[model samples]
Target: MMPTIVFGVLSVIIIGFALAMVLSKNLVHSAIFMAATFVGVAGIYLTLSAGFLAAVQILIYVGAISILMVFGVMLTRRGDISASNLFNKRIISGVVVSAALFIILGRLILTSEWFPSSFSVPESTVGPIADLMMNAYVIPFETAALILLAAMVGAIILAKGARRTR
Candidate 1:
């Protein structure tokens, strides 16, 4: 009972923070709200007994990505409040596309008949996960690292160029 109540509260916090992020006028404030949403999601993951995922969510998303987004926001000179006219052209199109996708997904879920499986996940999945990451997916993981490195280098170059212009 207590767990359910806690889960519900966390869920509400997550949703509220996500909405706050979208509605925030300030880009930097939006980034901070997004970080709050990420932290809330990490808490929800903890409630679901996914400790590892919760840790990764907090560390990678809330810690690294949120910091990067804030830094990117700081690098720009744009003011906090954007005019309503900024989204005038594509709003209807975006809404229609999203609604269509939602309808399709809802239909698919409702029509699908999933069977109950007796199979259960292993109690110790961490070892296998690490093994797969190190052995099977190492190349792809390293490629992602290389891509991030390139992005970091590009950001540095752009910062340098801006400094020179000033």
Candidate 2:
């Protein structure tokens, strides 16, 4: 009973945040909403008993990726918030393509065969994943983190260097 309620709440959060992210005009607000959506997804993963995936979602998406997006938006933003997210000339074409894809997906789903799914995912996935990350893959993980940090630093430097002269 409680799990169901929790799942419902997480689902609502995810949907709301995703909508806010997409519709937000302010880039920073959109990035923050995206981060919130990622957090909501982590909560859903928790409800599914995938603790490791939930943690990774929080760390990678919410923490690292969202921060990167927020920084990129902030650094590159030139005009006022109201001027952001304007409809492009391709809006009509984009809408038409999106509607066509949606209709195709709807038809595929409605016509798909539903078999009673009996799939088994190994319960000990987290154990082996942790073992590999901590032991054999530690250096690679650290190297990746170092590369991300260097990339972020380089981005900041480049953005600052391109500042227009008055």
Candidate 3:
């Protein structure tokens, strides 16, 4: 009952924010809407008892990616943050392709057997997963973090260089 209500609310939030993110003219506003969409996805994960996924959604998507995008928009001196032309001459073709793809995917989804007849939800916990990440996957995790750090530093340098020229 409560889960259903939560799911419905989060679904609405996710869809609304996703649409807003896509439709928003201002880049910053779009980033904010994207963050909201991430949060809504995290909420959905929580309702589904996927604690690790929820946390990752919040931390990685909302916290890191969204912040990086917002910073990128703010630091760059572009012509206009708000896009003037929302659609191009190829919009008709794009829409046709999108609709066809959607129909194909929808048909596949409706026909596929997602789970076995005797399938049961397995119990999950975050503790063992965290332990494994910190132990077995530590090197890979650290490497990824370093890569992100390098990208951020590069972005900062580019922004500073651009600022000096202007």
Candidate 4:
């Protein structure tokens, strides 16, 4: 009963903040809502007893990614935030497509056979997963980090060049 209640509240938080993030014009506000959504997702992970996933969600998505986005927006944003994504002819078409998608997804959900699970998740899966990531996948992880660094450097160079042109 308690878990179900928590899950319900978390779900509401997730959905509400996600919609707020999408609808918000201010980039900073959107980033804040995005962080809230990430937190809600972490709460759901906690409810499912996925402690590691919850930690990663909070650390990576909420802590790092959201902060990075907010800072990026603050630094790069010119006169107004709403300068981009202005309403146009695309709005009507986008609404129609999204509504059709929602209806199709709703039909799929209604028809799906979702029974209570007899199989339970294991108590702790952190150890083996940690070993695999740290030992076996270490190279891939380092490579990804290097790639991200290169992208950041490229962005900085582009920004500087654009400023010089202006």
Q: Best candidate, lDDT-wise?
A: 4
What local lDDT does model 4 show for residue 104?
A: 100
Report how far residue 73 has shifted in candidate 4, in Å.
1.8
Q: For residues 42-149, what per-residue lDDT tens digits would candidate 3 score against the true structure?
A: 998887677888999999999999999889778754677677325556767877998899899999999998874574434775776788789999999899999999
Q: Highest TM-score, which number?
A: 4
Q: Which stretches of candidate 4 lie over 4 Å from their true place?
A: 81-89, 113-125, 135-143, 163-166
Which is the winner by lDDT between candidate 3 and candidate 4? 4
The residue pairs found clashing in candidate 2 are none
Stretches of candidate 1 exceeding 4 Å from the true structure: 1-16, 78-93, 114-121
lDDT of 1 by residue, 7-35 (tens): 89998998899867866667777788999
Q: Ranking by TM-score, best first?
A: 4, 1, 3, 2
State how far residue 83 of model 2 sits from its true place (Å): 2.3
Q: Among all windows of ten consecutive residues in candidate 1, which has the lowest summed lDDT?
A: 79-88
lDDT of 3: 0.85
lDDT by residue (tens digit), candidate 2, 1-166: 9998998999899989997887777778888999999999999988777788999999999999999988887876887966577655676788799889989998999999989548666677599787888899999988999999999999888877878542
lDDT, each prediction:
0.82, 0.86, 0.85, 0.87
Q: What's the residue-level lDDT of 69 in candidate 1? A: 86
lDDT of candidate 4 over 30-90, digit per residue (tens): 8999999999999998888788899999999999999999898888778877654344447
Worst lDDT 10-window in candidate 3: 116-125
Off by over 4 Å in 2: 1-12, 87-89, 114-125, 131-166
